[model samples]
Target: MPGPPTIFVARQPIFDRRAAVHGYELLFRGSAENRFTGGDVESASAINIEQSTAAFGLDALVGERLAFVNLSRGALLQEFYRMLPSERTVIELLESVHGDAEVLEACRELKRRGYRLALDDFTDAPHSQPLLAYADIVKVDLRQTPEALTPGFTSRLRGKRLSLVAEKVETPQEHRRAMAAGYDLFQGYYFCQPEMIETRDLAPSQLSQMRFLAEVSRSEVSFEQLEELFRRDVAMTLRLLRYLNSAAFGWRHEIRSVGHALMLMGVRPLRKWAMMMGFLRLAGDKPHELAITALTRARFAEQLGPPAGLEHHDSELFLTGILSTAEAMLGRSLRDVLTALAVPDMVRTALLDGGSRLGAVLRIVMAYERGDWPTVESVRTECAVDERALTDAYVSSLQWAETSAAA
Candidate 1:
């Protein structure tokens, strides 16, 4: 059966002056097929965000930190802020929302209800002045405005009590400029970029775990070998037992042995679960979205395999999708990471080169992820898959990722 609608929720962290994470700006989108319909972008985005938050809960996306959500004029008029927790949600008024009487009245009402409000993509204009009365924070787009004019614009707001947020601060120089201009909050890719580390050697424990993962990924994995490997790692053994005993598995009896656990889960699911754990451990201090993306890709590729005429090799396709992001997660090339894990030749070749069937599935998954529909369509046609199957795979992958992440 088809699963839930495909919803993508990404959080961009907002940092205070001391470089502490103060909150996150929650970005959300609906399924790739329904994303762009030439409608009002802000309203559509607002609806998607509202639906996603309802389905997944706000804490799943932003943890305990404040969530800044963009509200279109329509959403503001609907009093959407009333539905969210006032203390934890910051209603960001989109730049497209003119500071007219209705919007201002709505903003005033929201403030009266104890909800904090922010002005998104703030620019010094005559029309924006009225919003200042209700705005607790104002975000200025560094990329859209000239550096020479930023100081002048920000200085004019010095008398106001609102905190200034500098958006799109993409470089060290821009960060410094924002700091100099007395901006209290910062957001952008500058903070999330992966820091390249020269040493690529896995820790001794991680090496052992990878070896076990490689064994499980084999076409013919032995139960005895998995039992022996689990026996060596006390934490893994306990985790497996706990997972087996959990309500999700609905085991009637307590799992007392590693072999028993392996028998219950079977080699296929065990391999996928272990690989996910290993990759997440290797991710270290990387952003949470990295794990989400990897798992989503893995599931998407696996589901797409049957439709793409590679049903017999779905596991290999899944591995290819997961390993495609290894370079970003491990700060090393895909070849090096795969070699370290001793992945299958087909999976390695698919990731390193772009000719294999698994490679084609990976390409389609990636293009679909980026909403590059034309490229996705071309690859889908080449693989002889229809749009419905592809959309179902994508949506199901998203649902699996969300559920797995919560687990």
Candidate 2:
């Protein structure tokens, strides 16, 4: 039996300060090896739907989280309902699924099992009309649908008592238009902006020293352990303080102790700078494409769910992503760095295996850098970080780097 080839889904919550997120629409993302096309359910059926649903169960659907997943006609015919607990998962009968009696009956039977149903990008269908009563939410894709006819279509569907969600609201203006049109839920980039920016290298040796500094920042090593790291690393310690105390950070007093400095700078912030340094550390001092993913993933992970694992006292996720491609950075296998720094097991799992969930997320970041839209998804189910927060991080990194240069 073949296993599910790792289809990660990241949800975008539709909420505001005025209202809590009532629901999240499940979006599918593929791995580095696979690209999930927006359409083509036939191609999707070639993978194991049962195992794929299990991965989704692991990544999402734990709590009261409600997600919308597109169901191909093939999945329904195969009795895929056994794979997911109907109570936790909602089946969005796809628009592409031809509205035959058997297909509609399958949807109706699934709904009878207490599953929430959605009509995917579909508002009206004579054959699927029976399934409409089962729909709890209606997704209105403002991006693809004609703007002029939206009001009329939305009005026609208003009486269904289903919540109208404006999917793919890409700008503030788009959000405003949707909200004004009485959209109960919203998704997209109105509140956040992605920077059209690029990163440059400072120098190679300086980068290595910064990584050494990052090791110090997130390290849980005792004072003696830290001092031991400093034995042959004196110059790195001095440069770290210089960068930390510079005018941009605006340290009013000269911070003298490493521990005190660590407390003030914070591990995430330090790791971010160290990532920039890591990119510059070798390969003739040119900004490489691979470094871009590491930086983006580190920046994105810092904004996500709680940081619990601190292998060797560092934020585990940051190292998981920042040092994911360590072999390339140092011109050796990750095994070399792992052996040298005494990194923890979890970090090892993420860097070398690419099998752990964190490893999966790291791959998403790489896909994102390469503009592989299908691969950059959240298999974590709930998203603590979305496009908005990431866009903000990118813009902020630029401003912070500029300030660092000035100081």
Candidate 3:
């Protein structure tokens, strides 16, 4: 007999103008298939939500922020969203859902219950015009909404009741244009791109983080050296010990010193932990979501390392994933960041060219982050891992990132 279905869920952060995460658009897949191939999308969505919420509390995936969940016409009519807390859930009506009387009545009922409504893939078509009346948010796909139309289009939609959200925004320029066009909310991976400032020197704090990351990356760094490095920075030392002593580690006794923590964790684990801390430090003044994104990528790549045939190179895999966002975090080119850290050729190549098995793992992880399941499948096939493994790795990585952030 076959086992139960494998559910895949990944979140895309939605940001305000200040770049702070306002909520997440939870992308769900009922099976390993990249796209919903056959079954009723409504049933699949309802079942996936039931199972995901029961198995892993909604709090686990989104924390305290709102969860933007997509719903089909049937799911919306059936009131499936009622299963979730109305206050924290944003009922996103898929573009396929029509705005007829029944649909509008369903939306009105949802509004009466204090649930916000969002219209996804919004367009200027007459079919979508009626939705503007009830929708609290209108998500405009910038890719489909032509550049010349943005100013006038956004101006037309700008109103006191509804806020405009710029979707598929992928660069700093796109983000700026969206803001200039009066978009109140923004989506997409634009924040992940490094803002390159020509001829700017690295900040002193970032330079210090680089030195620590470089030291940990060295193959022969000793416990004493690491201890001394931690010792020099009292705040970092406390954070390291505090993290080790957290419930996630579950040490029988309280970890007292940097030396004790280093000895217990050994070189490999210590290196990974220090690298994570280093990344957090390097991510100064950036959105908290950026740090979580890097951490999730790190853990996801690390979890997939063995399956991707890099079992012995987990440290390098973790580094490859975490540093993938270094350019964005530190405002330097990826090449410069890698060169400064003097990472191994394997890690450098993986981050730069996406070459080698390490690169395959990083590719899969990055694609999964964007809900690009087709690319995930292509790379997963290349790596010879099954869909369940990737999905499981992603779920666990999400949990691990949440824990690590709190720690």
- The global C-alpha lDDT for each of the candidates, from Candidate 1 onward, is 0.70, 0.52, 0.70
Model 3 is weakest, by summed lDDT over 10 consecutive residues, at 194-203
- By descending lDDT, how would the candidates be arranged? 3, 1, 2
Query: How many pairs of residues collide in each model?
Result: 0, 6, 0
Q: Write the per-residue lDDT of candidate 3 for residues 257-307, one digit (tens) a residue.
A: 788887876665544444334553455444346657876888889889888
lDDT value, candidate 1, whole model: 0.70
Those runs of model 3 whose alpha carbons end farther than 4 Å from true positions after fitting are 1-6, 31-39, 147-149, 192-407
Alpha-carbon deviation at 79 in model 1, angstroms: 0.6
Higher-TM-score candidate of 2 and 3 = 3
Task: State TM-scores per candidate.
Answer: 0.46, 0.40, 0.45
List the candidate 1 regions with Cα displacement exceeding 4 Å. 32-38, 147-150, 193-407
List clashing residue pairs in candidate 2: 9-378, 218-313, 218-314, 219-313, 220-312, 220-313
Worst 10 residues of 2 by lDDT: 193-202
